[model samples]
Target: MSTFGDFFKVTTYGESHCRSVGCIVDGVPPGMELTEEDIQPQMTRRRPGQSALTTPRNEMDTVEIQSGTEFGITLGTPIAMVVRNKDQRPKDYGNSTMDMYPRPSHADWTYLEKYGVKASSGGGRSSARETIGRVAASAIAEKYLKLSHGIEIVAWTSSVGGIHMFPPTATHPTPSTNPAFLSLIDTITREKVDEFVPVRCPDQAASDRMAEEIAAFRDKSDSIGGTVTCVIRNVPSGLGEPCFDKIEAMLAHAMLSIPASKGFEIGSGFGGCEVPGSIHNDPFILAPEVPPLETGATRNGIPRPRLTTKTNNSGGIQGGITNGAHIYFKVGFKPPATIGQAQNTATYDGDASGTLEAKGRHDPCVVPRAVPIVEAMAALVVVDALMAQQSRQVSRSMLPPLKTNKPEIKAMVEDGP
Candidate 1:
């Protein structure tokens, strides 16, 4: 269960309080340039103590390459990396109320029920620290996706508690129908997102409001939840697997796997349900001809779809497959459960109830730090789906051509629908 993907497999190891926490990444294409420097940026973004909105745990989160590369070139082997836990405070959770009662809405209760044993500090594998491996491994995938396909994945904090970056109104009830929202997704970059740090929302007004909201909660010893919106551009069409592994379905699985994440929505998502079929339908229009890349490399010489939707209510996916348009989604994180407030709960034995005041370093709002994790997971899903689709295309190319006699079918096949 620690590993994910069929082609680009990643097996993460270690725990929150372990000496080191990292991952083993397999299926990297040989001869690609990679190194610790290429991975450290994302790790730093996901690291704690970046700002006042996050946990104050001072972890540099410096990454080290253990294997699978020589002189910065990938050997197509398993790449191993590690990050030492420098500021571990296991004693914070030891010899206190934690031993008697499980924190409400925290993983402490379910983990004990599942494994019958819990880690000495934090949530063990369930901790946000475990996401270090995912962020590292997905950075590698992001590099590959960028170099080979010109794909770009970017995520930013879009909401805090109930305050949204782009609130729906009578004029624009859905973001897909708003040109401003569409333009933002198309042009927003990581640098712009980071410029408004602490909350990571690009809009200055929204970022300020979100930051104030988080600070208010932190002062109260409470926590709040928010949403992160992600956009993937220049992605090739026909990337997702059918039946079970739809692109959106896999994305949901990946996003929900992150600590504190509670909900996932793609494109119009739940909002589309209110619109009628006539308005919700994405009518196809001719896509502009894009010039070839400077590298002259594309996903098997397939540029992009000849046709695209006039209105992308479908979110660049049709019937679970990417449709060569920018794919966008939002992930909702639940308020961090491990607050500093005292609460009445039954002990592990369920015999007695008492107030348990939890003490430890935890984020008042996780959306800012969660930005990189969301992008990382998005990159993982895109890379895995791209590889799977490429494998099928390569295999299908080697087969004999069909000898059918139906003119309509043959013409459609020859011309490409």
Candidate 2:
């Protein structure tokens, strides 16, 4: 059940305070160059203790490649990656309070009820530590997408505790719909986003405000939640299926899977709801082709679609398929539940009441750290959809290449099943 993706699957293992947390990644393209170097940047960003806003717990969170490569190239096999837990405080959840009483808004109660027993250390499978596997696995998917289609995914903190980067007049009616913000879709890069670390919102003034808000909450022994906006660029049109696996649906599915995510929305999301039908629609116009760079789209000779939209209110997708425009979306995260503030709650026996004082390292505001995670999940969804779309395109061609063209390439794709 921990597995994700249809074609490019990842099954994660281990838990917080466990010996190690890792994943088994399947369906990577063969002959692709991969290494820990490609994966470490995102892992480092997701790691805690980088700044005052994040949790104080410190670990290198370094990734080790266990299998699925030879001479630094993928062999078209299941890739296994692991990150050992250097800091384990299982005793923090000792038999006293955490073991007897379910922390409010945490997974403690639900997990115990479901399994009849649960890991007292952290929230077991529900901890944010579980996402280390996802972030690592997505790095591979990102490489493949970038090499194959020139795709780039970048996400950043958009709002933290209501300290938003958007203009003041902007309202929920235009959630991330600022024409200026949307214009940054292709231009924003990870380096630019990370420039304002601890609160990765791109706007300097807004970032400062968000940072201050997080500090206020931290001082109060509480936590705050925030939103992340992500954009996917250079995705070939016509990825994603009808009825079931819409690109937006897949994106939402992947984003919502992160530990604290509470809501998911695609371009013009709830905001578009208030606009008139004529104003909300994206009008199609003929597209112009641009020559690929040496590092760009691996020149598979697949012709780019000749049409695009005057506006991207559809968020690069129409119905279920992509329209070759950049896809953008926002994810909402709830406040971290295990705040250190003292609270009165009942015990497991439902008998006597008690005061609980939460302990452990937790981010006051998780939005900054969530940026890499959002990008990683976006990479997974795009790569999986890219594989599906390519297979379908090959199948539908008027002249079948399977019989006469590029036998070696065909063999490589065929090896999966």
Candidate 3:
């Protein structure tokens, strides 16, 4: 279950308190330039102790490439990467209340029920530490996507607790209906998102408020939950499998797989249900001219679609496939369950009953650190879908063109950028 993807397979290893945690990334295109440096930035961003808002676990999170590359060039084999687990404190959860009673809402109980044994420290594989492999694998996928298709995946904290960067109103009940929100998605970058560290909200005022909210909860030994909004620009159309593996469906599967992720929704998402069909429908228009590909880069050569949607109420995907429009979505993470607050609960034996004050270093609000994780997962979904679509296109290209009398069908077949 630690593995993900088909063409680009990734199998993660290790645990929260284990010796090391990493992944084996397969399906990287050979001869591509790669190194540990290409993957470290994201690891550092997702590492703990970046700011007071995050956990105090001072992990350097230095990554090392064990194999799959020869002098910074991928050898067309599985890439093995690892990051040692330093500063782990297994004693923090030993010979204490955690031995009997599981932390309320934490994975402590369910993991024991599932495996009949639990890790000595933390949630083991269920911890956010598990996402390190995902981030690492996705870094490679992101690099390939950027170099090949000019794809850009960026995510930022959009809401913390009740404070929203773009609050819904009577006139603009959802971000899809708000021009300002659309503009932000069109131009926001990871650099701009990181400018407001600790909160990562793009808006200065909203970021400040969110930091304060998190501090208030941390002061009281409590925690808060929020949402991260991510946008993927320049993704080619025709990505995603129909019927079963719809683009949105695969995206939901990927997003929800991350630890603490409780909800996933694409553009207009639940809000679209409130609008009537006339207003919700995305009208088609001829796509404008696209700029030339970047000079001297390995290009995928996937042509841009001839048509695009006037309104993106469908979130860049219609009928389960990408429409060559910017694909955007939001992921909701639940509050970290490892709060310091004491709670009454039954023990493992279901007999002892008492307050168990959990002890551990945890984030007051995870949305800040969760930004890269969301983007990483989004990149994985896009890359996997792109590979699948590309394979199908290549296989079909070998056959003769369909000889049809219908002008409409012929026009559709010949349409291209």
Candidate 4:
């Protein structure tokens, strides 16, 4: 249950306030070029103290590739990665009565109720720190997906509560409020997303507003929630398994697993629910052949999506499978539960009511930090689905004639010797 992905599986280890945290990623293809550098950027993105909007707890978060790689290439075995905790301060809880009373809206109560005994960090096991392993592992998956299928996954802050870069509208999506990233979906890059540091919104004017709002929350010792939009480009069609293992379903599973995530939506999502079927349906059109590598455009026998929609209202997925369009989705993250604000709450025994002030560094808004994490999760889901389809496709194509199905057996029966 702790692990994710059937094929590109990652089992994360360690806990919050622990010596270190990391993961063991399995199912990576052999001979792929990989190194610690490939994994560090995502960890750095997910790490705290990168900007004023995030938590102040600064850990270098440097990863060490312990095993499963050799000569700058993956061994196709389990890849082990670890990052040590240098700034951990469990003693920060000494001033507060966290041990006596469960922080309101925190996991302290539910975890105790479920497991009977919980870790010292209470909800630390479910902390955003846990996702460090996921991001690291996904870096590997991303490398493979990019090389094999030219798949590119990028995510950014689409909205901070009501401050949306692209506000939905009735007709034509008014540009006044809707900062239409839709137009730039095909070209948006991680470099552009990171350009607006702390907010990561991509749009300059909109990003400034989002940053200001976060600053307001930070100054007031409060927090806010927001949504992150992600798009996956160049995924080959026929990657998903129907009836259960749909691409969107797997994407939902990966996104919802992130800490503080409240809701998940894909491609048109809730907005499509408002429009009529005639307007909402994505009409299919012939897709121009796409090359496996962008620099050198040449066919590689990977099935090109024969048809594409004029408008991606379906978000690159239809009927629970990928249709070779850019798959887009959004994840909504709730405000950080551990705030500096004082509140009146009951003790662990529920016998007495008292005030509790939470401690530790926490993000005022998680969406800014969650951008790369969303991308990481998307990569994991895509890589896993791709592997599944590859296994099925290769096995079926390379099958040997079975004794029962062989034509020679049919000929013998006809001869009646």
TM-score of each: 0.95, 0.91, 0.94, 0.90
User: Can you write out model 1's per-residue Cα lDDT over 345-413, one digit (the tens) per residue?
Assistant: 888888565889998899999999999999999999999999998788778667775553777655444
lDDT of 1 at 283: 91
Error of 1 at 170 (Å): 2.6
The sequence of per-residue lDDT tens digits that candidate 2 reaches over residues 53-124 is: 898888789999999999899999999999999987888788577766888888888887898988878889
Tens digit of lDDT per residue, candidate 4, span 1-417?
A: 679989999999877788999999989999999999999998888889988899999888999999999889889889999999999888876444778888888787888888898777635688888999999999999999988878999999988968988877786342211236567687899999999888999988889999999899999999999999999998877678888888899999899999999999888787767768787777777766644432221123233335677778778888888888888888999988888899889998785659988888889999999999999999999999988987875676465633435676744432110
Please identify model 1 stretches exceeding 4 Å from their true place.
290-305, 408-412, 415-417
Model 3 lDDT, residue 217, Cα:
98
Model 4 accuracy (lDDT, Cα) = 0.84
* Ranking of all candidate structures by their lDDT, best first: 1, 3, 2, 4
Which of candidates 1 and 4 is the stronger one according to lDDT?
1
- Could you tally the backbone clashes for each prediction? 0, 0, 0, 0
Query: Which model, 3 or 4, shows the larger TM-score?
Result: 3
lDDT of 3 by residue, 1-417 (tens): 989998899899888888899999999889999999999999999999999999999998899999999999999999999999999988888866789888889888889889999897988999999899999999999999999899999999999999999887777677898899889989999999989997999899999999999999999999999999999999988798999899999999999999999999898977767778898888998777755532221213344436788889888998899988999999999999989888888888886657899887899889999999999999999999998987887787677756545776755554322
lDDT, each prediction: 0.89, 0.86, 0.89, 0.84
Off by over 4 Å in 3: 290-305, 405-412, 415-417
Say what the RMSD of model 4 is: 5.8
Candidate 2: lDDT of 45?
93
